[model samples]
Target: MGTATGSSFDTETLRRGVEGTTGNTLLSLYADDAQIRIIDRNTQPSHPKVLRGRGEIAAMLDDVYSRDMTHKLDRCVVQGDHAAYCESCEYGDGTRVLAESMITLRDGKIAEQILIQAWDE
Candidate 1:
């Protein structure tokens, strides 16, 4: 995590949030009006799954974080008011999921996020 002043996106905070999502404590890292877009094979580019606002985002993420799996943040980069990261997770059944996300920040919180993910079928 890099340190920078006068920027809403804090690398340390983002790192903590990603690591804490499994603990269900990452909601604090998002703004009340944050939005999230998910794109994958099921949810194609033509029909992406979109979550609006903190409440919706939180609900969706809560379900994800509650899953029985182990999460790892493989890579992360923060620049200006934007941040990006790649994460991988493995479930007990040997299924694995890989996700890459781009986040936009506002007022030190996550305002919007776009994620593309793939999973073992």
Candidate 2:
């Protein structure tokens, strides 16, 4: 792993952003022109659920955060201009989810991200 590029990508902020009910803090971590590609049982590698810009990202985050669930940031690794993290979530109805993400950073904010997640049936 490489050292940080002296940017402001703090893991503490990431923790609060992911675990908090509101998506405000999380949204702030993304660049204005950021993009996110999500893959899951529904969305495959050939066709990912892509989110362009903060507008689309915010919508997704809001929808996710509004759900009755608990989110935890399990682990994170950071290198030069890049990062990866694992997140675990459990819904009110006992459904569990695990997600892994790789992100590219620019000026301390996330410029691009690719995420793959799985949910318990």
Q: Tell me the number of clashing residue pairs for each predicted model.
A: 0, 0
Model 2 scores a C-alpha lDDT of: 0.92
Expressed as tens digits, the lDDT of each residue in 1-121 for candidate 2 is: 3345577687788999998989999999899999999999999999999999999999999899989999999998888899999999999999999999999988788999999999999
Candidate achieving the largest TM-score: 2
Q: What is the C-alpha RMSD of each candidate to the true structure, in Å?
A: 2.1, 1.7
lDDT of 1 by residue, 6-121 (tens): 65555655556666646345778788989889999989988999999878987887888888787777888877778889988898899999999998877667788999999999
Tell me the spans in candidate 1 whose CA falls farther than 4 Å from its real position.
2-5, 21-23
The reply for model 2, stretches above 4 Å from the true place, is 1-4
Clashing pairs in 2: none
Local error of candidate 1 at residue 90 (angstroms): 0.6
**Deviation from native of the Cα of residue 114 in model 2, angstroms:** 0.4
lDDT of 2 at 7: 73
